[model samples]
Structures are given as C-alpha cells and as structure tokens.
Target: MNSQQPSLAQGLLAGQRGALARAITWAENADRRFPQLLEDVYAAVGRSHRLGVTGPPGAGKSTLVNQLARHLRELERTVGILAVDPSSPFTGGALLGDRIRMEERTLDPGVFIRSMASRGSRGGLARATVDAFDVMDAFGFDQLIVETVGVGQAEYDVVGAADTVLVVLCPGAGDGVQAMKSGLLEVADVLCINKADLPGADRMVADLEEAVHIRTAGKGLWMPPVVSVSAGTDQGLDGLLEAIQSHRAWLEAEGRLQLSRQEQRLDQVQRVLREGFDHAIWEGRGLEGYARAMIKASRTPHGAAERILEQLKAALPSEWAQVQEETQP
Candidate 1:
C-alpha cells in the first residue's frame, strides 16, 4: 500500500464524497494504489443493490436512469450513479456530458453521480466500471445504478456486474427489431420500452413480450418482464421500478444473488489475469523481441504463439505444471 492509500480508503469509508470521487478516478485510470485501497475497504462492499441500464442510442436510457435515481432517493435510499458515455476519439474523454440531465440529483448529498468514458472498451461499459462501482459500494450507497453508453450488442458486461439489468428501448428507432435481433433479450432482466406515448410503443411492447416468451418458454428460471414507460413524462416509472424490485426479490428468494456476485468476481479475476499477463509478457519481459526473432526465422504467428505459451507453461511452479498436465486431455 502507498502512503496515501490508507487515508483515502478511510475517507471513503467515512462517506467523504471527495475521497469516493478520487478512488473512482484511481479505478478509472487503473492506478497502482487502487488495489490496496480496494483491499482496505473490501469489507464495506456488497451492501448496495446494483442496477444496470443499457440500450441503443437515444433510447432515453439516461432520462430513465435519472428518474430511477430520483425514485430511489424518494425511498430514502442513498444512490450512486455511474453514467458511462462514449469516448472521444481524440482525447479519450466522455463525448457526451450525461450529467446535464442529472443536475437535479447533483445537489442532493445523498446522491452521487459520476460520468465515465467507455474509452473504446469492447463492452458498452468502461473497463473500470465495476471497479468504480465497487468503490462506490464501499462508500455505503444503498443503491448503485450504472447507465451504460447506449451501444447495442456489446453491452453484456453490464449484465454480468449488475444485480438487475434493464434493457431500455423506445419507439421509432428500430429499437424493437434491433433488440430482438441483437440478442439483447438474452441479457435483460427487465425490458423497458421507453417513450410509450409514441405511435408504435404498444406494438414494440408486444413484439418484445413475444420474443421474451419464445426465448424463455419452459427453460429459463426468470422470464423478463416487459414494461412501457415515457421517461420524458415520468409515466410508468413506478412499473419499471417495481419490475426491478421484483427481479431483485426473485434473485434473493432463489438464493442466486450471492451466486451471481461470486460469478461476477470470478469474471473480474479473469480480466485482471489477462491484463496482467499481457503487461508482464509483452511490456515488462520484452517478449516483442522474441516475436520479431520468430518472424525472422520464418515461423508462423501461431507457431510463435505456441512457443511463447510453452515457455510460459515451463516457467510455472511445479504444482501449477502438475495441475495443467492433469487437466490436459
């Protein structure tokens, strides 16, 4: 741990907003001190119920998220919102300022909102979004809502992190067809048809419900409930909230909440391992030279990769080598 990490972690645990912000920034930048800070505050995590909102662009996701935060606040719950925006190509910063709509909640001390840039991460979420959520969780928010950059198919990461995932769609945007064709239904715990006042909203709802029914049929444990809402007018917001609450209740009743989180943590570990291996082998170990040498020797890329993997395997501890050998066919 660094000299300042302990104090930062303490401040975060004490509910100091500045410290929470700093910790989230550290997570965003993947700072060296973050792991230590996370360790220090690890006990405080897992108290918050995480909800992820995701969909295609202009689906009123931000509006719905803002309204959800307000609704949660009305229930006397402390809310932490992570609104992820697409990255700017040049500066790698958030392209859209999502905080603009969330201005009402900004002044409330009980509500904390942070905007994160996707930074071209493969998922609609920023790579560090779960880390940021963890720090916020440790900060003692009762509810944590992550509003993903409304990118279509690549938004599955949010589902893996959140306790409930609301896939928001709206009329006149090809949203219904896109949601069905892009496999968004597979990831949704609740399907929200926003802008319900529009012409095709009911038809969109019917299409989604049929799709959800067809997909679930007799196999899945939970069939996602489709709800319609006009976030702009705040209509049917209660129904959306109720659906989320119902899903959470179902997860808890079925003893799957903890199981889901355990799986998510394992996924996080895999991502960290991949990143650590990439940095250690390519950057720290100067294995780029090995690749160049193999190229010069007329070795195929796959052959070079196999040789590197063999070297890596050989360098493992004896116990790991035995385990690997035992696992191999």
Candidate 2:
C-alpha cells in the first residue's frame, strides 16, 4: 500500500491489526495495489475456514455471528467477521450501524469485525466480499465469518464464497417451507434454526430435520445437519459447533475440502475477470463517449456492444487469446 511493500505485506504477516484493516480497505475500495498485496500474502491464503451465515431478514444473523465469534474465541481461535449490509441510499456507503451488534467482540484483540455495504450487488453480498475474505484469511485468522445482508432467499454469493454455508432460519417466519421453496436447503451445508427459545421452535426443527432427511435420502450426498440454537441465551452452542465440525470433517476427508476450495477459487477468478473488464471498458479508454456516439448513429445496442468487445479484445494480450472464446458470452 506504500512505496515499500514490506511495510504492508510484512506487517500483515507479522500480525499487525492495522495492516490487516488497511489491507481489507484496499480490497473494499478496489485499490489498484490490491493485486500486489495479494501476491505478497498469497502464501497465507487458503488457511482459514470461511463460514457464511445467511437467512431472511430478522433471522438474527448478527447476534448469531456475535455468539459464534465468542464461541471460537473460547477455543482460543482468532476470528475475522465480515458483515455485509445493504448500502445507504444517500451515501452509497456501508451504513456502519450494524457494527454495534458485534461491538463486544471488538474489545477482544483476537477478533476483527468489518461491516461492508452491499452496493447493489445481487444476493446481498458485496462484490468485494471474496477479496476481503482473502485478505482476512491471509492475516492469520483461524476462522472467518461472512454475514450477508440477509435480504432474502437468493444468497448464492455466500454459497460461492464460503467453505461452509450455514442457512439460519427461525420460528414464526414459516422459514421451513420458505427455505424449501427458495432452495435454501440446497445450498446449505448446515441448517441452523435460531431463536430456539421461542415458541414453535421444536416444531420448526423437526420439520427441517425431516426435510433434510427426505431430500438427501438415497442420494449418497452429505445431508445437512439441522441444529437449533438460541443465540440470546447461548443454548445449543455445542450442538451447533458439532454440526459445523461434522460437515467440516466430511469436507476434509478424501481431499474434498481441497477440491471444493479449487472450485471456489475458480469462481473467484471469474469474478475478478468480470469486474476488471467492466472497470477497464466502462471507466477508462473513453468508451462511454464511443458508446454514446455509436448509439446515436442508430447502431443496434447489440452491434455497439459487439464493437466495444472487439476493441477490448484487440487490446488484450496475445496470451489471452486461447481463453477468449471460452470466456466470452
């Protein structure tokens, strides 16, 4: 982040919290030097387990994440939390108020919590979520928790970014049926019924357990474990941890975890490419005026888009030619 890379990259590996926060800020802002920072810390990436906690709004994801951070801290594991929230319409920036929910954890030296704005990204995840996770992972956190905006049922961004996806549901939301309808069960590695102290919690748990059994029966796939937890009272924390550990153990066996991580990295690569190209074409090279002129000349939208792509393709490095066909839409 400076003239000397050692000050930033080495600082991160040296366990400096300032370096860690600055590194994540570089990611959030899409700083040009971010690629270099990543190169400096690439060796430390892939060491942390990223847990994505998501569900419908008001499912108490922040409180659950708060408790989960404490749980991991009790085990003496360092934790980094990324809470992605909806962008403020006025500022187009993260409304940092959500940080208050995890305020207690901030007092602990081992825990780092950052609130990010969704910035209109689909599935309630910021486009930079993966990058921020990579930075946090490189900073030596044993565990990383990504808490989504919890906008709704379509949260595949978490599924792609997190190694273990915990879909949190609660009672009185009719979330069991909602989860089924929204295919939340399909993406979840572990199903958590939060607010277990509330009425109808038992019935909700039973329903989800039966659903999981029914869905995975005879499929030979890892059936998602259904666990209920009352984050407010801290009940069923061990059960929740056990369920998560069971899934993690399964992923670790037979190199499945490595395979899964490779797939996730592939997704990250595509994401980086798309965002990079979008920025290059639309934000630089005067393509906006070119596009406007072409459109004003009565060119079809698709035709103008094709010409822009042609310009981009021509400017690309020769080494990228082989992959052009596959990458092009």
Candidate 3:
C-alpha cells in the first residue's frame, strides 16, 4: 500500500503485454493494496472497446471468444480475454480449462488471457471481472473480451459493463426462444447462433428472429441481427466480426458508445461505494453486536438492517456522506 508499491503497479499497468497478465492477477486477489492498484488502473485507463460474451452453458461462448481474439489479432489489435469459469465444488478452485480452447493465442504476443472462477457469485461473473477489464483497458489493450459463466439468464450482468454484448446460443437448445423471453433477449446487441452446422440451427435462428422482432416491436432501434457460425470449422467468423463492428458503429453513430461507457463507470463507482459501506458496517465489534440484534429480532430482519444503515451513515467518511442520502431508506 506504499507509494512505491502503487508506483510499481502503475509501472506494471504501463508494461507491455506481461503487464496485462500481472494486472489481472492483482485485481483478482483481495490484497490490501488492491484499492490503490485499482485507483492507479483507473487513472491510466483510456478508450478501449469492451465486448461481453454471455449465454447458457453449451452455447459455445468460449469458442466464439477464442475466434474473436484471433480475428482481432489479425486486425493488429492487442486483445485481452477474461474467461469466467465456475469454481470446482470439491477443490474450490477454477477449472481454468479455457486455456485449452485458446491454445492458438498462446504464442501471440498481442493477446493476453486470464481465467477467473465465479466463486458462486450471484451474477455468474467474478466480482473482479470489471476491475480486471479496467486493468486491461489501462494496459493499452485495444479490445477486452469478458466471457461470462453463462449458467442462467441472470448471468447477463455483462451488458452493463460492455459496449456491445453478444448473446451466443447453440442450435436446438431446449426452448431457446423461451429462455430469451425473460429479459436476456432484450439486452443483446447481437445474437449469435453458434455451432450452426448442427441440426435445427436454422429453426433456432428463425425462432430467435421472430422472438426478437416480437419483443422489440415498438422500439425503433435497430433489431439485433442473428449470425450463425460453426466455431469448430471457423465458419462465419468474418460475418460475425462484421456484425460486432457494425454494432459498435451503430452505437457510435447513435451516440450511445460514450453514454454506455459513462454509465458503466458510474455503475462501478456505486458498487464500490456500497461495498465500502458494507465492509465498514461489518468490521470490528459490530459483527457480534449485529448477531445479538438479529437474534433479538428473529421475526423481523428489518431491525438489524435499519440500525446498521444508521450506524453506517453516522460513521461514513465525508465523501460517502453524499452517497448515504440515496443509499439510506
């Protein structure tokens, strides 16, 4: 946490590709120096395109991400991949098997890859994914691809952090259209029918197109185009890349790109502030006092939360005072 340490983190943030990998490591761990490192990373960040890839399991998101990285590298862009994997139930460690799918990029100096374990976070993305994105952004990567652990519909937290979101789906997945109805379909900037060579691929595409049309009936914004690709054979990659770039162009033309980035940064600030408040509330002797209060108010959980918030507001730093007004009930 010293000035020298943060200076070193800043140095690493500015280092070539190796700096990206190191930044990811620093962001993922809960080191005490993390806050300072994050500040340094944010201070050095610039305009980097962040693409979020999400879908249900078996959607071939990993394959798509690998292909996308290769495509970006071909275009002479420095690429960073943050692949989110679920933690092993027994070992409590990430499988980290994405490296196998991304073998082609191993020797590519322009590409940096890191695997993160979800740790059963509610969003199916590790809490540090956004921080890792900023670190990569600050390290001068032109493109940062965040691949979510697409376990369920709610795993679509990537949309808030990404400039363009690709919701990848495999053909013939049971009730594909129904899965999108809950909200995921509405958030997609692009829909990818990965593994398109499989049977029912066409049907899935048709169904998704109809569903998207039906859902966005009144909205004038461009409807998300569905692109089919067989990642195994590298089919339709060019079209997919074109679709991704087209969405970026659309966002820029519509003036949504800068808006999206601003929203994402503010969202992160809110989340960080909430976490700081929560940490301060639970630190020291308050945890024991809270347990006693909880036991006394067994029938109503509200008592402890209300009391905690009041205490939190009173103890918060001056900067947090401005946030407490909205955060407090």
Candidate 4:
C-alpha cells in the first residue's frame, strides 16, 4: 500500500507483467496488502488450465517443461510457468536450475516463468506456489504449468492444486516399480516416459501401460495413458498434447471438472484456516511462551499442547465442537 507504488490490483486487471510479478512476490512474503489484491482480481481467475508436472530427481522435468512452453507459445497460448526448486538451506532461495534452463522462454512476452524456492516444504511445492498460480491465472494466462521439485511417491503436493497431474518418468530408473509402491500411478492423469531414445524406454512404457490397464480394468476408471517422448529430440510432443487433451475432455464430461475443482477449493480453504488459527493461537496469543514455560515445569510437549487445546475449547465452546466434528475422520 505504498503511495508511490501503483495499485497492484488495478495493474493486474490491466495485464501488466510488472504488477503480476509484484503481486506474486507479495504472496510469497505474506504481505499485508495481498488480501485486497486477491479480492480485487479473484473474479478473473479460473480460466487457465493448471497442469502439474512432477517426478523424481533427474527425470528431465525442466527440459520437458521448457519444450512444452515453447510449443504452447507457437499455438498462441499465453503460458505461466512456476518452477519450484529445492531451497538452498543456507539462504532459503531457489537453486534457479529450471530458470537457467528456460532462458529462451524468458524473452517471450507470452511466457512468464518464475522460479520458487520449496522452503523445506515436503509436498514438492513451495507454500505460496498456489497463491502465485491464482495471480497468474487472474493475469489471463491460458495455461499454468507448475513444475515441482523432483519428488518421491509420497510428496505428491501438486495433486490438489492442478487440474491435470502429469507424472514424468525416464528410463533406467526403476521408476516403474517405485511408481507402483509410491502410488504415483494413483494421482497421475497422464504418464510420460521421457528420454524415450534411451535404453529400456519401450519396456518401461509397456510396463506402465500394463500397470495402468490392471489398475483401471473392471473399475470403470479413467485409464491414464502412457506416452513416450524424447523431449530432448522433441519427439512425440504432439502425442503428449493429445493425451492431455483427452484427459481434459474426460474431466469435462458430466460436470466432473466442476466437482473436482469444488473439492480442491474446499481443501485449500481448510488448509488456510487451519494454518491461520494455529498461528494466531500460538504466536499471536502468547501461547508459545506459555507452552515453553509448561515444558520447563515438567509438562510433556503433548500435555502442554492438550492444555492449550482445552483452553481454546473453553473460550469458544460451540465453534470448537464444530471444528472438531468437521475434522473427525
């Protein structure tokens, strides 16, 4: 809300890239002015297709995403790329590997690429990644590609934020077995066998196809297609696009897209509320110091936490009961 700075909400509505950048920074920093900007620009969201790309390290995700963004620009689609990289522990900043590799796209006006630090988040994404996505969507990008830090089976953070989850795997990694054990196959809307020119590529593709066939068979579920692509050589990119489009069509059928988005929105709301309330109780209300004092007096950490919860319940009886009931499994 600096007087010298232009109104970010107004600038975002006007499609100014500088405003978009600043707004995303505000999201990253939890700036006080962000809520107003979000309120002003929220109606412009929901038009872009969010595609989440994730895989284990060394899977060539950045290369594939660079190629995809270039192709999208050729098709006249404005693209926003969020590359969430592992944070440097010393500085809590992005490694910038993905941004360095995507130098060509930086010059293109249609492609806005931002590199984000994961900041020790386990789910493959930075905490503010989804907030940045919303601002980019409001800026009128036709597509938003969120590339996660190379992730394992359990770090499937992109699932809730993306409309399509694209799982990328390369040959010679034993990723096929890992995918099954990690349940990567469960969250994937499309699977890409990247580095298709390498050895074992075809075998990996076949194995994944068989896996998909088995898991989806007799359940009437949407079978995630296995696509083989050498993004390095730019081979079979069109087929990848087709596979994604087919999934999009399936999701669009019978209001499935609407329902899925609604559920994800609800999840986002719950996460935000939980985080805010926890912070308010511990930090804002001086409970953090009290917890420490209780620990010093021989109370276990769990016991201190239970005492704090009891205090909160006493203060807001009906509200606390509703929260507990809603959170019950």
Screening candidate 3 with a backbone cut-off below 3 angstroms (N, C-alpha, C), the clashing residue pairs are none
Candidate 1, residue 138: lDDT = 96
Q: Which structure is stronger by TM-score: 2 or 3? A: 2
What tens-digit string does per-residue lDDT give for candidate 2 at 1-329? Answer: 26856679899999988998888888888888889999999998998988999988889899999999989999999999999888876778666566778889878999998888887687778988999999899988999999988756566888789989998888988756765677788889998899988899999988888788888989989999889999989998889988888899999999999999998899989989998778876776657888887677645998877877787679879878778877897
Q: What's model 2's overall lDDT?
A: 0.86
**RMSD, one per candidate, in order:** 2.1, 2.8, 3.1, 2.5
Roughly what TM-score does model 1 have, to 2 decimal places? Answer: 0.94
lDDT of each: 0.88, 0.86, 0.80, 0.86
Which runs in model 1 stand beyond 4 Å of their true positions? Answer: 175-177, 321-329
The residue-by-residue lDDT of candidate 1 on 1-329, one tens digit each, is 57898999999999899999999999988898989999999999999999999888889888888999888889999999999888877787666688888899988999999998887786889899999999999999999999988776756888777999988888876755675787778889999999999999998898888888888889956999999998999999999999999999999986799899998898889888888888877785578888777767656888877877787778888898678889997
User: Per-prediction TM-score, please?
Assistant: 0.94, 0.90, 0.88, 0.92
**Candidate 4's residue-wise lDDT over 65-148, tens digit each?**
998988888899999999998887788766567887789998899999988888867789987888899999999999999999
Stretches > 4 Å off in candidate 4? 2-6, 293-299, 317-329
Off by over 4 Å in 3: 1-3, 89-91, 290-299, 310-329
Specify the poorest-scoring 10-residue window by lDDT in model 4. 1-10
